[model samples]
Target: MNPGLLLPSALFSLLALLLPLLIHLARRQQQQPLDFAALRWLGSKPKPRSRFRLDDIPLLLVRLLLLALLALWLAKPVLHGAPDRRTYVAVMPGVAATTVAMQALPANARKHWLAVGFPSLDSDPPADAQPIASLLRQLDAELPSEAPLVVLATTQFDGADARLPILSRSVDWRIVAGAPPSTPMVTALAAPRLQIRSDSAHRTQAGYLHAASRAWQTPAEFTASSAAFPNNQQIVLVWFVSDPLPTTLLEWVAHGGTVILDSSHALPQSRHPVSLWQNAAGIDLLQAIAYGKGRLLRFTRPLQPAQMAELLNAEFPQHLHDALQAPGVAPIPADARTYRPQTGANAYPQAPYSLQPWLALVLALVFLSERWLATGRRGEQA
Candidate 1:
């Protein structure tokens, strides 16, 4: 490795070396003339030549060297070279540690789990679903360009992006024969049950919501109640009342129960209210605000055909259902052998190592030497 300076401009501080030279010259001893009786009577002869001589050469040299090193320290010296490269072995959660240990790995290779935090292989395996391709790209960007990577994964991998990752180096992907993660039985999603609470004045409008719920094909579980509040069984509630909502209704919304408020009702103040439903003309038909884990939705206008044309549209039921339910996450499962990373991605530059601490240590030693040479008994006797 070659030594270099980060701030070469700081070398200008070397001009301080002149201080010791000036001090030595100014402290040189002067010879005093004595008045001799016989010589004083004679006329002054030719004047002798004066020679310039420095005092305490050893002490002066130490001070000058100390100042020169101080200047080098201010320049921020560093060592320049490529970072050390080593083999990295990352085992996915489904793969057993014993299986990985049995493989003939490099003697200096590091072992870690391919999870969110990249924990050690000796610790417990991660239980939560991990974004495999995302974590792979992260590891690729972090490792040195010359470092080799070995990924041991099961045949069934999840949480992959749309395309395979392109890394700086070609990765060695190994598929271990082990039992894949257990999958739950796949079933169709259950239809959302609806509960409606309305005053007598808005009872006619409540029928519209009831028709929408029937369109969900879950009418068997649907209930229209004039009760003050709906129970936990009902996942969605239509507030057809004209009056402002009570605190209890807000509490229900905050507890993960979706509520649809009357069109005339004003939505509560929120930091960020999202538009959940929009018409073909790009007009927002419904606005929603998050309340804890749940959402509070409100129609922009009254449910009459003249005020809101969407209420009479053919797709109104589907639109209302989509607004009430959150979108489902798509599953990502693929064969590990086919998902090997490509090698065309851009490379990241490694940072140079700093030598400031070493320079500071040397500077401290030089300072102590200078102090000793300037103030010790030998220096005083000289």
Candidate 2:
């Protein structure tokens, strides 16, 4: 496989040839005087011809050729094939809702979706849902023969089947799950529960203001309400069950704003007609929505500060930064460059070599060669 190692093998082959030559030369260098005392015994016994003969040139050539071939094989010759280069686009849906919704989509849709993006979702979600393994088998039927898939999720998952979904035959899938919960930060920033005001318009304008005011004061309450739209940060809306999300949210999402709604709350009930805007891409956005090009993501659960940091660092950093940078959106500064792939590289594992069989073949060849040389020596003695 590697030509650089062949030089040493060639030298080894030469050494094999030189061993016999050196032995022959050393024999010739020694000289002995003839003794008359041995003449009677030498005459009585039939003189034995030399066991080694220079006339066996063809056999010597064959042995040397075999040694050279064996050495060359040991050097590990390999033929390089064409380089594989292909670009792929991935669409990762968030956990549970994504896992179940994938089953509901058309078989062709599942195949097309997995072919581009990561296949597996996080193991767990904030809400109750089916396991990832079950989802994988259902979606496996639609995956592409070969490509790279990217995974996006609202939460990280851990389970027996944790590998990102990709076909052993062709595709390579990389998983990118959302940040997990942080206990300390969640405890510190925990929002106080507020009484649900039946006044819909007031709730829309300042739902958490009254509760925040009770803990702090009137000025603090006014400041918090005014500061709801932070400068330089992308605004992410998390809608729950009690308050119906307005259609204006769609305009925000369409413009690349991050809006997360809980499926438990956002899904339609018998009392109200479920809005079609909520089910973008058939994945209940009430579940989660991550806009790839816009660099924006929306999730239902309020994450801890550490979890939030992990999301920015590991998940969709590009979309996150893009959403933050647009003045039309928010003023928060985002680190967009995190978790980028290496330049000119694909996300695939390299193959490993197992050399036991090759070593066995070499040993067999050495044994056969030694046997042939021994047989020739025995024939000469006979």
Write one digit per residue (lDDT tens) for candidate 1, span 1-382: 8889999999999999999877766655466778899897899888676545443666778889889988998999989876668899998778877799788899999899898789988898877446677688789878898888999988876545435678888888888965545322222225677777778877767777788888888752334444655556245677888777765565555444567787788764422457778998988888876543355678887777887788888899898778666442123356677778888989877667899898889889988987887687466567
My TM-score estimates for the predictions, one after another, are 0.49, 0.28
**Deviation in angstroms for 186 in model 2?**
24
* Candidate whose TM-score is highest: 1
RMSD of each: 15.8, 19.7
Instruction: Give every collision pair in model 1.
Output: none
Which one is best on lDDT? 1
Instruction: Give the poorly placed runs of model 2, Cα more than 4 Å off.
Output: 1-13, 24-55, 66-79, 84-363
Candidate 1 residue 98 Cα shift, in angstroms, is 2.5
